[model samples]
Every structure is written in C-alpha cells, then in structure tokens.
Target: MQKKQSEWKWQWTKVYDDSKWLFTEWIYPNKLKDFKGKTVLDCGCGCGQHLNFVAPYCKQVTGIDLNTPRIAKKNTRQHKNVKVVEGDIAKIRLKKKFDIVYSIGVLHHTDNPSKSFNNIKKMVKKKGKLIVWVYSYEGNFLNRTAVEFLKKHILLRLNKNFLWVISNITAALMYIPIYTIYLLPLRFLPFYQYFQNWRKLGFKRNNQNVFDKLNAPQTFFIKKSTVKKWFNPKEFAKVHISHYKGVSWRGSGVLK
Candidate 1:
C-alpha cells in the first residue's frame, strides 16, 4: 500500500485537470443542485479539482486524500468554504459526518476497496447520500486481459519518466482512432460511449488521462454484484446502481 501511495503522489504531481463534464457523468441522478447548502466530503479528492466545482454550492466542503494534499490545498485556497486534508479513506474517520459523501474513481485504486467503502460510508450522515464510481468488470474484458497483462508485466516495471513518455505516445496514437473509427455509428463496439466522452477533451487532457491509467500502481475492476453488496438494503435506502457508458458503475444510496 505504501508503494501504491507513492505512485499516486508522483502521478498527481505530474497531471492536473478539472473535467466538469466527466464529473457530471460520474455524479448523475445526484445533480450539482442536490449539493446546494449541504455539507460535502470528497473522500479521495485529487488536486481539489472536483472540490472547486462543489465548493461554491455546498455550505462546507472537505477534500481528503491519502497522498500529500499540497496540490489540493493550493488549488482550493481561493474557496473559503473548502478544506483539504491528508487522510486514508480506508482508515481515517473524522469526528463529523457529511450530508453528501462521494468517492469518484478512487475506491477501485485502493488496496482494500470494500474496507475503504465501509470506512467512507461511516462518514455519511444518516439519510445523507453516498455516491461511488468504479471500473466495471463486465464490459472491460480487453482492459482486464491484454491491458492488465501489459500493466502487470511491463508498464508497472518501467521508470516513471519513461512511462510518461510512453503514455504521451500512446495518447497520440489513440487520437487517430478516437476521432476516426470511434466517430462511426457503432453502438455495439466496446467503449463506444466511453470514447465519445473522451472526444470532447483536448490532446493535453487526453494525454493526462492515459498517463493516469498507466501510472496507477494497482486497480480493481469491480463487478455490479459487488457494488450491490456494498449497499445492503438493511443499511441503505433508495439505492440506485447503474452501468455507466458500459465501462463503469455509478451507485448512490441514502444512508439509513
């Protein structure tokens, strides 16, 4: 876990961007208006990008991360309502719970995702909302097989500097297919909707996206069944779990 933490710190230091549209995609059914005047916690807030979006509407927003929070603090310094802190989502427990708690694209990266999910849920106030997004196992067959093989055997063993260069090259190579073949009306294709979202971003952000996937020290492609198990009916109500872009899962529930 220490080694994985170090990899994330190095990754965050290299890339920073606020994908507002991507945020919307991940936080659906729970709109930005849902956060109005509410206390919010971004369980694994990286660089405070998402915090920037929510701080304006929320009564108070706290962004917590496992890595050093220097970038998050700096990025959110202008927002008086925002606080950035260093903490492990799988271990740390603050004194107070929040009206809305979210962990976007973070839990799957943790060493113990279920433990982390349980820990983060404890931070949600009774009747408050808990939202999470994770890589889905159902539609990520390519990622789970070929990509996973390369990552585990080759990419993970490369030097950070070299890997960044490789990521840049890979992103450039992908730009062609993304704009050409991906533009076709082929809903049956894998990652068709996911690639559509990527087309909206520029080259720089796309490169950052590529680097992020390659730089992660570890990751878990969660199943829909596992996501269902996390939101037990005895503990939660109004639970909504949906597949996102056929490549991921977005789930939200009201704590009981």
Candidate 2:
C-alpha cells in the first residue's frame, strides 16, 4: 500500500516542480461560496496548490496527504495560516473539525474510496460542507476502458522511471495533434474551445496530467449513484451531484 501511494507522491512532486502555473479554485463548477473566515481542510492536498489558493480567503487551511508533506510545506511556506501534515485520508484522526472538508481527485485513488469518504466526512463540522470530485465511469467510456487496461496490465507493473517516460510519450502523442488543431483558425469554432483549454495548459502540465492518470495503481472510476449513496441524506442537508464533460463526478453538500 505504501509503495502504491508513493508512486503518486513522486509523480505529483515532479509535476508541481515543473509546472509554471498554480491552480487556486475548483476545476469543476459549483465552487464554494463565502469561504472567508471559515476553516478548511484539504484532504489529499497535492503540493499545497489549492491550500495556497484558499489560505488568503479562509481563516485557516490545513493540507494533509499520505505523501508529499515536505513538498506541500515548502509550497505553502509563505502562508502562516496554512498547515501541512503527512497522513492518509482513511486513517488520519483529528480532534478538530473544519467548516469545509474538500477532497478533489484524491479519494478514488485510495484502496477503498468509500472508506476514505467516510473518514473525510468526520472532519466536517456540523452544517459545514464536504466537497469531492472523483473520476466517473459514465463519461470517456472508450478512452477510460483502454487506459484502464493499460493501467492494470502494463503501467502499474513498470518501474517508476520507465513509467514516467511512457507517460510523457503518451502526453506527446495526445497533445501534438490536439494542440496542432487548436492553433489553427478552427479554434475560432464554438466546440474548439473545449480542446483550447488543454493547449493553454502547455505541454509539461499536460504531460503531468496524463502521467497522473495512467500511472496511479488504484484509480477507480465510480458511478454517480455510488457517489450519491456515499453521502447519506441523514448526514447531509442537501446533496448536489453532477459531472464535467462526463470525465469526473463532482459533488458538494452541507453536513447535517
């Protein structure tokens, strides 16, 4: 389990160190509102990117991850209100609760995503919020199927160095053609805007994205209904579940 988790640490550390941009807000819609003065907990926080984004608005932001605490700490070093801790989402215990417990693109990589969801839920204060985003089975059906097989039969078995090389190669194959199209006058078309975002991310970040997707050992593509069940109506006041271009499951709700 530790080895499997360490793979993600190495991949994300490389990405964080290499990428020129820093993401601050939720990538999906239904973003949090009125975070000012609230306490936030970012479970599986990678390199403290989101923590740095939220720290200025919230009273405090705590970032926890099974690996990469050192990177996270260094990334958020300038923010006195931000704390970085090394811990697993499924096992870490804290006495305090936060106004918001957010775990995006993290839970589904766990050995048991449902267990991690329950553990994260415990960190939310009563009437507070729990936000999550997981890879979805409904969207990207064909592409996901192909990658799933590669992940199980090839990528997971490769050494870290070899896997990194293959991931970058895969990124090149994907980006070259798509970005070529993006640069043409076709980009002015309505639907071309979708692929335009990828071009805007630049080559290295796109490579990192692909690496993170294919290299992880425990990537579970979950169903929307399964995610809805994860948030029991008894525990949450209202739950909102949606998807982004059929690629991810986005959910947010206030704890009861």
Who wins the lDDT comparison?
Answer: 1
Error of 2 at 116 (Å): 0.7
Best by TM-score: 1
User: Would you give me the overall lDDT of model 2?
Assistant: 0.77
The C-alpha RMSD in Å for every predicted model, in order, reads: 1.4, 3.7
For model 2, state the Cα shift of residue 142 in Å: 3.4
C-alpha RMSD (angstroms) for model 1:
1.4
lDDT of 1 by residue, 214-247 (tens): 8777889999999999998999999999999898
TM-score of each: 0.95, 0.85
Candidate 1 residue pairs in clash (backbone atoms < 3 Å): none
The worst-scoring run of ten residues by lDDT in candidate 2 lies at 17-26
Estimate every model's Cα lDDT from 0 to 1: 0.89, 0.77
- The TM-score measured for candidate 1 stands at 0.95
